[model samples]
Target: MKTLYTLGLALVLTPLPGLVQAQASAEPEIASYSIDTTLKISTDRKTRGVSDTHGEPGLELTVEAAHESGLIAQLQLGSVSRVNYPEGNNLNAMLALGWRGGNPEGWHYGLGAAREWFPGARVDEAPAGFDASFTPTGWVNTRFHTSYLVAELGWSYLTARYLYVVSRDFRGANTATVCGNYLLVKLPSGDLGPALDCYGSAMQHSRGTQLLDLDLSYPLNGQTKLVAHLGWQRVRNFRGLDTMDYRLGLEHQRWGLVWGAELAGASVRNRDLFIAIDTDGTMRQMEKPKLILTVAKKF
Candidate 1:
């Protein structure tokens, strides 16, 4: 249930050394603070190799403010798929507060706290026909959300990040739905089998889920760069829900716009854990492999 959003890669990375830096000895006035806003459109909105838009296009707007002392605050808003948020969700929103420092040529670090909100979204039942014999008694009856703390460390073109979930559950993932789905397939004969007690507690929470990732951006030329990322997600108390995700891509920047294309996919351990059902009765796998294309403008 990792719901991290796709961040614009080209716009966020530091350009090739000396290619975009001002002369070291030149005395240029420095602003104490600045604000940046970016609007992006993409073929799909991916979070850790999973499509949040259910293989559809996505639109996003992000605003960030930073001070000379390294304090930063950011807000992100983006389109989401109804398949993944059936109850109702116009957009996904995230707010983060953090600090980043150190020379671009040397070591750098960032620490922050972020929370993702899916307004009006809820998962109260299994998809129709998914498990008619199963009761939805144990489902969490509230809006979905994810809260986590992030820490990052980087040197030049390489960075590493770790996210630790602090909420009662990671997104909407819980043992109740997982176990219920398990019984659906395991007991196709319609027999209760080993009884409810054999399935363990149905009320377990996924509070300590974690994500660790490494990102690389190497300049292929002044206007183009090679980008890659690898990430692993571990769901605490749910070993079967773990996954590994990957991305490899190229990005180019010109004419005040950034363009990118990436091959992204994931190795999902449990297919039922991340399935989505559309309004048309379509069942979708959110972790499929696909090429993602994007264009973004920043001001």
Candidate 2:
């Protein structure tokens, strides 16, 4: 893969011992990582069989920072359902090579990929190959990397009636074949304000469309700082159980922390992927898309 080749080349191109010694003599190498803790406070959380007391709160923690090698490892701990691990309470990690010198340094653009697991990060499923003796077998992986071309983008704003949000979810299941959209939006952050699609509180992916979140945030300091949350959320259509997608975060001095709780919402007992044609000539869907609780630390 191109990504693999590029990473290999970057690592190999590092200057040799003598060259490194010269740079080190000029400036000692200094590296550091950060860990942020977040807490969640929720409202009534219930739908089908899953339910958190109306006032039940949740939590999660995420630690992600830059590396000297243009490589970054980001880890998130919370509750969400995955294909391989359906049980609640899981953690996830995504390590990638970042493009730090670009027009925007704070904007992380790089290579590499990620995997998911429960209680722990989801595992990287083995590429479809074979069993002992070359026999072929494996479950049809339905999330994350097993899913390529699965790019996502979303936007949300608080309004009087509801927390408005719209999103498009794409996945490249078979390298050659890509699956389409899953859209959703809840009314007023449902319960948890805004978490993320393919990222946080994923149990919210019941339908895959235009949905909203229950968002609440407040300033911890005057400027460039705050603590917020996208509580628990509803999956719009069938109204499955919602998770208390809560988080506590702070942003200041161009750096901060984001972490908290993530509970899983139950899947729709009865449902289907709703589809449509967008005004942009591309295929679109009236699906129930997922939401995200975002906290950025700038440097």
Candidate 3:
């Protein structure tokens, strides 16, 4: 009986090392977490040419985590020198779930849902008895929120994405659907090793907004690159409101640190109407020919 018991114990111990190795090998290897910070200095802080900071600099810090299962969560904190609110800062957080597979040389698709929260971010309200023919008094403080369901499909140097807004603030100006497509072409080495990126987007809401853009990047050296961008935008609802914008910039990356400087400007038709009204019924024109500097670190 003693000899039989010893044989059973030996049988169990012999496979334990192999079992541990198999378990370890089965763990997913792609899970990661990262934190990054960016300091942005611009003459005007805005989204798509709508002024948010009223020509003030902005700083942002972001922390993100991702799992091998394609779940991601991120928190972004931003501060501006000026905002409609007295606090001069805001918080944005997002949680997303997505799956990405396949190599760049093959067709790939990613579908995800992201819930974005802008805690305490103010919404711009139309003036009392505002008319659609005329612009609102200006953007004022109100509660604004949004969510998105997004999908991307890509193969090689071309990609396309569709973004649908599931929720938004009471303001009717927000876009409900956005579709974007981009193509990248790498120029031959003799052509200064420049790369060209062409993009187009259509945003749908009460009306359609379309944008076409071209970006070029040329390597200046091992660590520095020169970039230029030009874009044209049109709004279907607002006639004579088409605009052209451009940017010239240079970026350098070294030791996981990135820095950039850009000069950007936009020419807008009926620019005054594009300005947002403040809670105090103030309308400030968008600043043009702005200089921006940015520094970022990744970990």
**Which residue window of length 10 is worst by lDDT in model 3?**
176-185
Q: List the residue pairs that clash in candidate 3.
A: 123-142, 138-276, 138-277, 139-276, 139-277
Backbone clash pairs in model 1 (N, Cα, C under 3 Å; residues 3+ apart or in different chains), count = 0
The lDDT for every candidate, in the order shown, is 0.78, 0.31, 0.49
- lDDT string for model 1 (1-299, tens) is 11223443232334686675433332334447778899999999988988888889999999998877889899999999866665666689999999999976779999999999998887675422123354444434544688999999999999999999999878776655555444544454565553243245446778889999999999999999999999999988777678899999998998989999999989988775556656654567789889999999988
Q: Which candidate leads in TM-score?
A: 1
- Model 3, residue 81: C-alpha shift (Å): 6.5
Put down candidate 3 lDDT per residue, 106-206, tens digits, no spaces: 67667776665556554344232212453332333334445666676766544555555555331133222110000011222233111111111222232
TM-score-wise, the better of 2 and 3 is: 3
* Each candidate: RMSD: 12.3, 17.1, 14.3
Candidate 1 regions with alpha-carbon error over 4 angstroms: 1-31, 125-139, 179-199
In candidate 2, what are the lDDT values of residues 1-299, reduced to their tens digit? 01111111122334686674222222233454433334332232222213222122223345565544455555544433222122224333323223232222122233333333334322233233333453333323434321111221222322111221122112212211111112222223353222112122112223332223343334555554444444333443223223333333443433344332233343332222222222343432222222223343332
Highest lDDT model number: 1
Candidate 2 wrong stretches, greater than 4 Å? 1-58, 81-85, 88-99, 103-108, 119-299
